[model samples]
Target: MKKINLYITLKQGVLDPQGKAVQESLHTLGYTAVKQARVGKYMELIVEDDANVEQQIEEMCTKLLANPVIEDYTYIVEEGIVQ
Candidate 1:
């Protein structure tokens, strides 16, 4: 068996209005000095095999997991032993 970890983040040049809103709200709530913030996505998947997993995960990210036009995604695949 195998496990996949996916991380998706906004592209460098993309603006994150949601993150900014959260930061502003935090400041108003007395948690100042928060600086800047960005939102991202994390996902995990359990699969049966490791072969070509990276390619497959990348394709999944491109096709459905992430918005390639505004975000970037990366993943790691690891072997899982099922006893």
Candidate 2:
């Protein structure tokens, strides 16, 4: 088995309204040190270990998990980790 930890985030110039809202709220609550905030998605998947798994996962990310036009992603694969 294998473990996939994927992180998805907006492109550098993309607007992040959710993150902006969170930052504004934080500042209201006296957390004024934050200069900027960005929201992102994190996903974990466990799949059968195989030679094609990484490619399959990349396909999934591009097709459904992330928006290629505005988002970028990275993943880490772990071996022998089922716990």
Candidate 3:
């Protein structure tokens, strides 16, 4: 089996309203030292062992896991026995 960790975030030059809101909330709560805050999505996927796992993951990301217009995605694959 393999474990895939996917992280999705807004692309550069894209406005992140959620992040801005969190930063403002933090400032209001006295965390003024924070310059900025960015929000992202993290996902874990388990798949059957296959030589083409990486390719499959890339296809999945492009097709459904992330928005190509405004978001960027990266993933790490860990191969080991499934627990």
Give TM per candidate: 0.87, 0.95, 0.95
- TM accuracy, model 3: 0.95
What total of clashing residue pairs does each candidate reach?
0, 0, 0
- What is the lDDT, from 0 to 100, of the residue 45 in candidate 3? 94
36-65 per-residue lDDT for model 2 (tens digits): 999999999988879999899899999999
**After superposition, which runs of candidate 2 have C-alpha atoms over 4 Å from their true positions?**
none
lDDT of each: 0.87, 0.95, 0.94
lDDT comparison, 1 vs 2, better candidate: 2
Best by lDDT: 2
Write the candidate numbers in order of decreasing lDDT: 2, 3, 1
Q: Write down the worst ten-residue block by lDDT for model 2.
A: 74-83
Candidate 1 weakest ten by summed lDDT: 74-83
Which residue pairs clash in candidate 2? none
Residue 51's lDDT in candidate 3: 92
